[model samples]
Target: MKFLSSLFAIAACGLLAASVFAAEQAPQLSGCAAKRQDITTQIENAKAAGNAGQQAGLEKALSEMNANCTDADLLKQQEQKVLDAKREVSRRQADLNKAMSKGDPEKIDKRKDKLAESRKELQDEQEKLEKVQPDEDDD
Candidate 1:
């Protein structure tokens, strides 16, 4: 129990520090924000159309956009953001697993929620990246 608490505390502190650093070094998107917004709107429209296959294809397109974004440095930063978020989610999941193995139901549920939130963030970033690009093919 004590070890788990300590682990949680350390993770929390690390998260806080990373978040602060990210905030300080936040990238400026003033020039391309509008285009990004438009792309996101298109993605949402596709997602709401109730077509599973189309949605999956749109998601793949989104991932490509994130990978091949226009601004070289911004694209690299965005990719790093995805990687960092994924790592954090994985760490949380492992912590949750450890807690569950010790019968911590409440912590387990909380961790699951955190994981879902992380995944949602990843999806959102992908959508933003897709919004920046010009769609070449209609899928």
Candidate 2:
């Protein structure tokens, strides 16, 4: 029993270190490969932690990815995300405007922070959309 527990602990530690190392490496995987890799990683993590439910969910996701995933659909999804992000930015800008009109410094700062966060989200979504574009064209 002790040997088995020690082995499990060592395996878990190895997985953790590998994940951290991979994250640090930050390979620029895009499109279906990136999506599949992410789901696979989650499945592995769930299995290692003995989370059967999560592992099943990830397995389903992987199957769905294998079945119905397409570059065009992915591109459209990314585009929609960018569109949603833009709308959020617009809404945040309006909130900031309203706060400015009230001339409350605290409210202004709060709105500014929210706006900044939304803007950053928008930028990140836009970047993701750009990355998806190449996959669409390659087909």
Which candidate achieves the best lDDT against the true structure?
A: 2
- The sequence of per-residue lDDT tens digits that candidate 2 reaches over residues 1-139 is 9999999999999999999998889956777877888899999999999999999999999999989888789989999999999999999999999999999999999999999999999999999887767644457
Question: Clashing pairs in model 2?
Answer: none
Superposed by TM-score, candidate 1 places the C-alpha of residue 47 at a distance from the truth, in angstroms, of: 33
Name the top TM-score candidate: 2
In the range 9-107, model 1's lDDT, one tens digit per residue, is 999999999999997897544214543554566678877887678767767766666666555555566667778877877887787788789887898
Clashes of 1: 1
State the local distance difference test value for candidate 2.
0.91
TM-scores for all candidates: the values are 0.44, 0.71
